[model samples]
Target: MFLRTPPLTAALLSLALLYSASAATHAKENAIASAKESIASSEKDSTASSAKKSIASDSYTYANLHDVRVSHVYLDLTVDFANNALTGFADLTLDWQQQDADTILLDTRDLTIKQVYARRVDGQWRKVSFELAERHAVLGSKLTIKPGFQTQTLRIHYQSQPQASGLQWLTKEQTASKNQPFMFSQNQAIHARSWIPIQDSPAVRLTYSARIQTDKDVLAVMSAPTEPGTARTGDYRFTMPHAIPPYLLAIAVGDLEFKAMSAQTGVYAEPYILEAAAKEFASTQQMIDVTEPLYGDYRWGRYDLLILPPSFPFGGMENPVLSFITPTVIAGDGSLVNLIAHELAHSWSGNLVTNATWQDLWLNEGFTSYVENRIMEQVFGVDRAIMEQALSVQDLKQELQSIDADDSRLFLDLKGRDPDDAFSGVPYTKGQLFLMFLEKRFGREVFDPFVKKYFDDHSFKSITTAEFERYLAANLLDQHPGKVSSEEVNEWIHGRGLPASSPNPQSDAFLRVQQHSNAWLSGLSTLSELPTTAWTVHEWLFFLNNLPLNITPTQLQQLDQAFNLTHSSNSEIAHAWYLLALKTGYRQVLPALEQYLISIGRRKLILPLYRQLASTPEGLAFARKVYQQARPGYHPLAQGSVDEMLKAD
Candidate 1:
């Protein structure tokens, strides 16, 4: 799923402004397209050469992949809960790209390297000399080892620091099962360097195997598929047969119990949340059943979910085979299962075919989001899917207003910046919009096959935006002449904002909800008279989102009184209501909001609330006070983001 940020304050105006582009805008687009086409025509050969070079260049990592590449990683690690660290050695099998190269460089962050050993072609392991380079604020330190010529493997013994960015160690009190501690890894976007010493670039794909030792009382899981009837002993083994990017490497240790949702799908959570999570996500098999016939077969053997504690930073991290999900999504009614669909779609778009660099993140996210909506439409009704799309578009428009034009492009230039900071609604939503444009122009009959073939052709590979464009042109656009021009595609990818021809998702359900919202805000009807009992989560979000920006405190109170929103069991509805309460200065909701912030640690839900609270002096003090108490429970990523946000305020 895309990183969730707060919606812009002037969402209604932003939506109007996005859709109502003036004639001059069209003229400018044509001019820009013509110029871009000319430049592309001139630089076609150089551009191809540059594209090949860029495919291997990743700004995020210090690994020199051109010299030596990592083929497979074998981790023999022990979970040390007392020290809040993982102490072990990683045996990395190397593929010598340059025969003359004798040195291998790997990425590391806040790790203490004790020793290094190299395995020669004769199968003898000998101690090797290594150096830890100066630390980089973002890229971490580079561990360089001179294993000598003809060495095919290296074993690096290291220990992770307590404050490693990727791994979060939670105290027993921070877990649902208060009797045991929990630890999980969130390694996307370069955080993997903090825990494991490897080529931490998405451009390099490698298979991995692990033997993780944890407390005998707790269960341990990895991104790899687990064998049926595996022993529950402290020593656990896993193997990921297919090669994947390092960021997809994941591990979790907790007092987890599993319940089968289907023959291949299951839920793993603490005893407290296992049943609820399983019930809420009972449709996992249906999602896979529907997605496989459209896309290719499910390449990864089994698809299971691990419901992490509330402190899991993202809504869901699409770790292969086993996805790390936040507990906040178990809303009892399964209203938020779209998040599941989004993550499952990543099985194809992201895990099977990945983005070569963070700059082309749209290749992973945009494709997944488009496929997610398709899955939603297939499983849930079209009305629900359209409502979700409309909400996404609304959020994107608001996000575009604040995001810089350069960052707004589907092809981002995040050379000197952190990819995490560069995230926004642009890649996920705008990329989806680009595909929707193509789908609309060339009907699904033509587009569906293309999507299926695209996934099949690029399975188990990392690709760049240029590579995808070339494939699209050859397979889809060129095959069906006069359907879409290269210029239009260029605009969607390289242009600052949405193109004039962008598809606008409209929902009849949201329209009716807006009508009721307008009626109540205009004083034509009382809140108690509105028909909300039958409303779904999507309808509630639309209703609350379209409420007038200047809604008074009394108006908020009336809505809360009638709907009991402040006390709603649904996390989505409660978050929307809390945002409104903060905006309207309704102090009655403060206690609930504070409790909500403390209990839930999903960045998407909590970041916006904290930002809203920091909008005023009194609220800022309250936010700080609450954050001090809530800080221990938050994951390192959440803690860092919230700290930066509050510090900036």
Candidate 2:
């Protein structure tokens, strides 16, 4: 079954904005959607009145999951590099929680369902009756199947559409080798349904194994354990013993090779860059060692990293055993290895203990952020950790100024909206600072055990924010109410705006950078006189970000000539310089700025630059031109956001 949507016109988008202006309009629309959903849910509940059922996860998935419990999945797929798609079958093993339940609903998007079969109590598979529900713009379709009473497994044969949002196919020109094609999957925040027929919710976790067939010369890796010394025979097999949410099921197929940094930690890149990437990430095992003491053990057996080509969207995606990271973070000086720590921490907080739903996202991000700094402090130094925290605090304050006040809360009500829109520095930084506040009040010696205990109690389980709050109160607050109260904790978790008790993050290194920025603005120093010889990427960013918004082109020229930031190899520094160039209209750096925008496809670096350039007609035309060439290499997540902005008036 297939569903099609007409492309949106500028006039229609304007009309949409007008219609959305009224708060009542938003409320009424939500009420209508909710009522429709309630009627559907009511039917499912009515079918199994006596059997226990799980609450429906607050997600866009149409799965009637309350009556079924998925245990394992077997995926057999052929990776078609020429056509840029995955044609496969998924065999799922599940149990019916309610004896009378007779139907199964799975989530899918941009997928063509060819056939479905079920195994009966007689141990024979037979074709099953299935229906494709109506599709919403973002929610996709629900594949409902009527499996008879004694069925224990279902098999779905489907092929991903060319426009599958989770998959990105890159031509040879997009890679460093410039000779082989590449493809990868980005499935976070519910895009898994675009490529895989499964229950696409974090609230659902299951084990999976894969058999991937690709081109003879290409290598395929997944978020599961692979055999060492495997030959390139166009077929690869992987298995995961630990269960994970659908978003954690990832795959990459390309001209790639693996280099082991340790027995359990390694790096994957194209053959030409394998050694360099291995060297760059030599500290991965050390990070794991440091992280295990903070939380419990690293439950995931191996912590490997796949350094994808430049067009990968995010800084890092914490896939269970294999982390997909952008090449931009390989700054060659070991300055950006803290991102490794962050992803490694996710092995505990996000992979092992997941948020029950997207609304409790801070339960994953905030806890991971706090643990990331702890690992960085122990592996690196306290000063480096402080610098990272200070930068996060700076970013949080800036984010709070621009976003809705409701979005600033750690616990969010992201109903009737795309969960990806809630992603920002708010959850990471604010959650970390709130935990820091508790540590300050109760003291580290008292609170350290609680941190480890929380992870231990909830390992391998999805939890809501309320459950975490109850855990916090039962373990720490109830015993020592005089130190901190539940009301204060609520202010940080549910209330908007930063809490009064949030920690003040200070960095001595940034203090010096601020002084130089102040002196330059006060006319007491020339651009060449600033002491930046020992500055790191963070210091350079602070100096550039703090410059006055109304600075002249002459001042920018003097600074750019002195520092040569326009040609810097560091992606973070180059991104900062490009943004400043846009604000100042420093025409001299336009060529380098354009190169930066096209060469790096990381959404963190490019999205803001594109938005800033789209503010003026000439710049907008230039952005559109560069994007036309860059769009083929960009991931669908990045393409979706940039396409909307460029298409707008």
Give the winner by lDDT. Answer: 1
Question: What's the TM for model 1?
Answer: 0.91
Query: Per-residue lDDT of 338-399 in model 2, one digit per residue for the tens?
Result: 88888999988888888878888898899889999998899889888998898889878987
The whole-model C-alpha lDDT of candidate 1 against the native structure comes to: 0.84
lDDT of each: 0.84, 0.80
Alpha-carbon TM-score of each model against the true structure? 0.91, 0.90
Return the top candidate by TM-score: 1
Q: Which 10 successive residues of model 1 have the least lDDT summed? A: 1-10
lDDT of 1 by residue, 15-84 (tens): 2233234343535433422332332234322211112233458888888887877766778799999999
The 10-residue segment of model 2 with minimum total lDDT is: 1-10
**Global local distance difference test of model 2:** 0.80
TM-score of 2: 0.90
